[model samples]
Target: MNGLRKGSLVTVGTGIQLINHITHEAVQSIRNAQKVVHVVNDYPTQRYIQSLNPDTESLNHLYGPGKPRSETYRQMVDVIMGHVRSGLNVCAVFYGHPGVFVNPSHAAIEMARNEGYEARMLPGISAEDCLFADLGLDPGSNGCQSFEATDFLVHHGGFDPTCSLILWQVGIIGVGDYIADGRPSGHIGILVEVLREHYGSDHEVVVYEASPFPYPIAGPMVQRTTVGRLSEATMTTMTTLYVPPLATKADRDMLGRLGLGAPQRS
Candidate 1:
């Protein structure tokens, strides 16, 4: 028993694009694991994962029409844990960063650690990374704040309009169950109403979706629309809303306290 190999778990991300953005470390983890369980969006990526490991299994079948996503996530965690308990090294792969907006990955890792199993997560490119490159916007230029669309509306306070605001899952805002069509069934009208108070009707916003395919195959969807017209914009399960910051003057008092003059802007 003492000489037997112990169970371990490693979670990785396949990034937004199919196969193009997978990291070397993530690839190694997938290739070396005894079992590879994944939840990738595209068929090509699913095939790619299978190529890397013959023992690959998909958790996508857990999702069903009208099923609560919370239950699906719970089931996914249980499947991953089952592999670990059998003394097999398991690799769990998710689309985009495994740690970003992935409920099952975090839950599985936490549960594994709690059960005295070795578990860790590797970093991968997220949708936000692709957004910055495709949109040519720098988060450093203005501070960035990110939140789920529903959470932002429910706990709408202390969020600065002067900084770049990103609201994820705008299409599925209030929807808790899985749907086949992945439509914007959520209350998008409520989101538009709330944003109108902060940035006004004419303020431009982007309805963006990072392409799951490689470059030349497809490019990201970037729909620039005003706050007033957001309700009419195209939104899907993959859509993320990008709200540019409102222009504001610098704080003269803080500059004075720092003994600095006005900084030049580009």
Candidate 2:
């Protein structure tokens, strides 16, 4: 412990969009840090951060075709820890919410804490946050369940088909490595088959991708298609599946248990 140097690590999110999603606190963290490292999806956000702090470095270079995403994440953690070890106040920025499904951000924070450094993560607007707004959805209404597409298929997680289901990372469903062209070629058919089991062949579903740019005014791609036509929908690395409820609510017993009166059936 005597030879160990004291450093601090702060992880923040730039949100899913450009500069508009960035919070004032997160902006201050980037400006005040001795060194800044980031991984973002688009060039505009990257340039925005660089403009705020010229010393900023991008970790996106670690990703490559055929390279395992896990390996790339580990490398990202190493780069962040490297600066922290150099006794610099390091700040790591990621797209969307830093702690939401970001392996490298979590790994770097854990490693920094283990090394006796003060490490913290700040929340930012995630794709789900945008989805709820753009889709006119309230999670409290009918209840919402979210899962990674791969995990949902592999584990066959118990979920209610009568409620809203959100599956993330659908475009890269079965792939474990990075692809330069962002085209994934694995097990999409299997995912569609599994979904049909619960949603039925004609059940309507939506493939959603939140717009990252503000001025472009690109809203979510709400494709109203059956479960069987899922494979035909255009998907991207950021695409998420939204499954709406099939059953209408008429549970009088449950409603009475909660001390609520039942509504008149139409």
Candidate 3:
């Protein structure tokens, strides 16, 4: 601790788009911080943060090819904590929702709190938020479930086929370490096999990736492929899989229990 001064940490999101997605409060936090550390994907967003705070530093340098992602995340937490321990007002920025699919942000906040520092995360629009908007999807319409691809496969999670499914990290399946120049191997095949069991090999699915830039894009890379073709599809770290619902099954016994008539097809 520097003197008796209190050090605080605030995590904020840049959202999916460069400048447009950041909230007014998030920007103010960046402007007011003594030091800012950011982890973002695009150059324009990084430049904007640098312009807002001249003391901005990027945490991206912690990442390396062949390095385990967990190691990189630990390094990120160390960097954030290092500034806070120095009694500086630190604002850490991450692209999209800081808490969503980001392990380091949560870890940093927890560590800071454990150290008797004021720390919290501010919510921002995530890729899923954009997906719901650009794709005209209402999760309430049929219910929706989202999961990490590898976790879903490992746990053999059960999902309702009548509800929509969104699988994130589809491209980096089974990849424990970071590979800057190469993609993962064999995970896609396993994913396909698992999905085929539930939805059948001919069941249609869509691969989606939200655009970080503004171009009035209607939808992501919506590939209409069967479960069997998932391994053959073009995918990236950002790719997400969308599986539409199967046919709604009538439950006459349940309807009768509720003193209601059976469902009629429109």
Candidate 4:
């Protein structure tokens, strides 16, 4: 079974945009793999992945209307394992960072390693990276908090409105099942109410979608609105909500303890 060790797995991300964000290393992994499974952005990206490896297969067909996404993810992981168990070097690529929100990527890697296969994940640019670039927001400037919209509403233990808040899957706010067309989140009002409790109704927020194709798709889409008006904001399954912090005084005692002065760096 020594040769079976050659049947390894590597998962990578295609990033947010098409063609541009794929890393050189990930490109090599795709080309070298005996079999590649991809769940990417659009047709063009699919073709690009296909061009890299003729053995590429798409898992998009696994998705079904009104189906639970957890099952879909499980099936995806199973498919990846099938390739690996067959002693084929497998590459499972997903959109955005493979490690970010891609459940199947993580599940497949864990399962592969558990089965004594060499499995590793490579990082790729995510929507969060594009959000930082497009919105000119820095997590370091003011500590940032990120959460899935439903998780934030249903089970958030604590969150700081005094820090930037990013709510992912804003367009699928309360959705429990998968929709083929990515139906607009029907319960955005619940999210707005939760945010309104922390930051007042008039506090500004943004609905952001990073462009996938870079044109007519509205490159790096951004819609600015207030917490109260968030319900009126446009969003898709890809949308993320950004809530900036309200003005607050720095902790003078902490600064003094650290022998530092008031804010100076920009």
Q: Estimate, for each residue in 204-229, the C-alpha lDDT of model 2 and write its tens digit.
A: 88888888778756756777787999
What Cα-based lDDT does every candidate model obtain?
A: 0.92, 0.88, 0.88, 0.88
Residue 48 of model 3: what lDDT? 96
The 10 consecutive residues of candidate 1 with the worst lDDT sum are 1-10
Best by lDDT: 1
Can you give the TM-score per candidate against the true fold? 0.95, 0.92, 0.90, 0.95
On the 0 to 100 scale, the lDDT of residue 113 in model 4 is: 90
lDDT of 3 by residue, 63-156 (tens): 8987899999999999999999999999999999999999999999999998888899999999889888867788887788888889888874
Candidate 2: misplaced stretches above 4 Å? 1-5, 248-251, 263-266
lDDT of 1 by residue, 49-99 (tens): 999999999999999999999999999999999999999999999999999
C-alpha lDDT of residue 169 in model 3: 86
- Estimate candidate 4's alpha-carbon lDDT, on a 0 to 1 scale: 0.88
Output the lDDT of residue 244, model 2: 89
Prediction 2 TM-score vs. true: 0.92
lDDT per residue (tens digit) for residues 1-266 in model 4: 56336589999999988888999999999999999999985999999999999999999999988889999999999999999999899999999999987889999999999888999999999999999999999898878998988988988858877788888998997787886787797899888777788888999999898888766646777899899999888788889999998777788898898898985434
The C-alpha stretches of model 3 lying farther than 4 A from their native spots are 1-5, 182-184, 217-219, 250-266
